[model samples]
Target: MSFDRACRVNVGLREPNVAFEKEDWAVGVDRGRLLVIAEHVAPGVPAIAAAVRSAPDDKSAMTELAWGLRGAGLAAYIDWAEDPEDVQEALNSLRSRPGAMSWDWWDDEDCEDCDEAEVIERFLGLAGDHSRRYGAILFEIEQGGDGYLVGFMEEGSVGMLVDNRSLRVVATGWQNRA
Candidate 1:
């Protein structure tokens, strides 16, 4: 099975004239869906025009924009710019979890009879389920070949990362660490 490992920046832009420099990275901006994965930049890197346009001058504007993005079902990771304190608190709570980076089933011995594909599917499903529960934004990280690291960002910061392996998901760490 093949997986598309490209990490896309999904944005909901108010402006229609915005364009990107790297044509290769430009996925396409379709207003019809109101959810466009237009730019395929490296993970954690925001699209230039989207970033600039989303960024407002004042705190009130920033908060308003952040809400607008969220309301439009856009996962822009704009909470950091909107409210850093709340985001930090959420991160702290996530990191404090005893099982944040460790799981009992995350070992070969624990799932010796388990199929690799099934394990991957379960991990992905869990990630999605948690994302919805926490109202988080999902990010994908390419880990070479068929390997991928999925991150769930809630309240602007990363709350969890899951991988195909029963091991090394947490060991990989967050953001650039992957």
Candidate 2:
């Protein structure tokens, strides 16, 4: 669906134009629909798995995860930009660090009003059911103390939440779920 249908305007921002405001970030509705404007960026599963094991919480794990995925493989070269010209610049920045996730544009530095524990709890609440129903594995990685990374691997999609500020899909593929 579109952002207009799936997103509730973030009250913290005066206008929603992707500006660098604390509240400009938005999350998809709990109903499991997302308003993704950019193309999907493939994530590094090996990196994601390693970060998950080392990071303290979901948010921190994502920061590390983004770094891993940024330089993973063929998919690492892709860039998501509003303008085509900006693609190279974004890709450059992404590659600059080599193995770190960027949580710079979070809505509220680690879910703002929501606590880490609470965010994890909520994700568990929603993801548990979703994972069970879809036969997918849903998880949250730390974007930092202020953000989270939530991910879901299903028959048709591979998604992750960066800093818990937003959810981005790296790959949209299907796997036979038994």
Candidate 3:
């Protein structure tokens, strides 16, 4: 919908309906980094909507959103949905449906996309491997603009970009206020 009114949730609250392990949150955070990069590099592009809607359901979308925030280096404040069960109910009918569902409307445009389960699985596998190796998650959200910035942060780090391969910081902070 309206990016201005786009809501955000953290990973420490109630877990979404879909099964989201710590690994899922790690990956979600990583994805968030990429969304942040897109916002900076492609001002009008709706990467967040695209990515979130691509999930199988609201729980999946929420998990994916958390990853997106983490990817953007804003991990500290991304709280899990307060009432994940409600979100689950909102998406129950659509969980195993066979069509793209509308997640939001952006400027009169409905944001709809089929959930890419395979792609998500691949990313999770990658993240899980990294998590096992370094005792933390290492992920890169690239916009391929001024520079390809790869953000490395502990799986549980707040919002600090521990390592940046390319561009410097722009806006860095936790989205949720605890």
- Top candidate on lDDT is 3
Measured against the true structure, the TM-scores of the candidates, in listed sequence, are 0.26, 0.28, 0.22
Clashes of each: 0, 23, 18
lDDT of 3 by residue, 1-178 (tens): 2211111222222222223454443332333443343343333436655776576654465555545644543332211222223322322232121123232321211113413332232332333243324434323332211211223333343233223211122111112212
Candidate 1 structure quality by residue, lDDT tens digits, 48-151: 32543454432223234334433333322322122323332332343212234323223435335646544443444344434444444345322122333333
Between candidates 2 and 3, the one scoring higher on TM-score is 2
True lDDT of residue 175, candidate 2 = 9
Candidate closest to the true structure, highest TM-score = 2
Query: Which 10 consecutive residues of model 3 have the lowest summed lDDT?
Result: 165-174
- Global local distance difference test of model 2: 0.31
For model 3, the local distance difference test gives 0.32
The whole-model C-alpha lDDT of candidate 1 against the native structure comes to: 0.31
Residue-level lDDT of model 2, residues 18-117, one tens digit each, is 3333332232122111111012233334444555456665334433445555445221222111222232233335321223322232232343575544
